[model samples]
Target: MFVRTENFRTFTKLYPIITTITAIHLVLWLIVQFSENFLHLTVGYNLLVFQGEYWRLFTPIFLHESITHLLFNSLSLVLFGPGLERLLGKVKFISMYLLGGIAANVATLLLAPVYYSHLGASGAIFALFGIYFYMVFFRPDMLNTANSQIVLVILAISLVMTFFTGNVNIYAHLFGFLAGTIMAPIFLGKGTYTRSLSQIFPNMRRSPSTAGKGQSIFWIVLIVLVALGALSRFM
Candidate 1:
């Protein structure tokens, strides 16, 4: 719903870091579906990590155990990631995502059971959601009261799910949320103005002038090609 209404047109216009991240997740999901060894190699907090493989700390964020898990995370990311990326720009947005998710994984390694195998983008998605929650109050202009209430409702539901659901990892969610809260002030800066996707691509349309129209078309094709190229890796 968020993707259909708020981001449909804009997704084509702007550099969608959120969508890119989601695509990466989906692509990896596809790989995991096709390969048996993929999951064993990439999952976080695994026995391999304890044995000296360190990259598992970050690789787990790219994995999901089931379609339901990926679906919920993808939805949350589609809702929250674009907004934050639009507000913070690509660099800071990505930084927050990596740092927040990694923080969650690190915390999980310390707090969760050694035998527990954690995977999926729930922590990262929650990290973005936590930043969204923080922005609701501190950057009210960007996230209005109505949107704020929606975020709260989603978070409340997630918290309830964490407590009630057997497979949910609350520790990852908690630490990710904390990481987001801690990083928001640093990456979000003091700006309150939220830039629309259209604003980022004001000259997206074909113009009457031949050169201008050509340039616009070139840009559109370039963006589409890049997106397709990135997507082709998983297929």
Candidate 2:
């Protein structure tokens, strides 16, 4: 799961996309178990109507109760991460992973039972699907034109899979898709991949740019909103 400079360079030099994705899949698998155990040690998650443990929202993404389920998520994560990471780089890619997953948790809490424990990378992968589609079809000029139609076709097929498949976490996927879609227009262009976090945070003035001190405010607000949203399920 860990990557050293040599391994990164060697793999990135060969199968840059696939190799990076494989690494992410491995790491995520480990994190899922760790998250579940951590939650049990602290808050705990339920099988259904998931306890408003709040942490369950994030932890569930890490644990897959079954091997087949893990396999599907790993495959999808590996397939999705490389393409998106190669484009978004490590920061935005990581942001997409965490934010998309959080977005999924939000949707799951709102729509499903609070005790219904859920886990998988479907939300993040779906976000990648949305972002990839945007980079390809919505902004084809950003990349080579030959890949544009191909990417669009792939997006269509994946969207169809959600509708046809029975247990594909379609709700999480849709939520991730919407989040990624909303962010795409803000960052999409024919230049280096970049995102502006300051736009969302209202207090960054022209001077005193050490916004690091206030980063916690972001999480505070996010968690508060999530907490309030989760409460709606019980009422």
Question: Which candidate comes out best when scored by lDDT?
Answer: 1
Error of 2 at 235 (Å): 35
Residue 118 miss distance in model 2 (angstroms): 1.2
* TM-score, predicted candidate 1 vs. hidden true structure: 0.75
What's the lDDT for residue 15 in model 2? 45
Deviating ranges (above 4 Å) for candidate 1: 1-12, 190-235
**True-structure Cα RMSD, model 1:** 11.4
- Report residue 10 deviation for candidate 2 (angstroms): 2.6
Q: Pairing residues by index, what is the TM-score of model 2?
A: 0.60
Against the true structure, candidate 2 has what lDDT? 0.57
Task: List, residue by residue over 179-211, the lDDT tens digit for candidate 2.
Answer: 777666665554345323232233435354543
Overlapping backbone residue pairs in candidate 2 total 9
The list of candidate 2 runs beyond 4 A from truth reads: 1-9, 12-52, 189-235
What range of 10 consecutive residues in model 2 has the weakest lDDT sum? 195-204
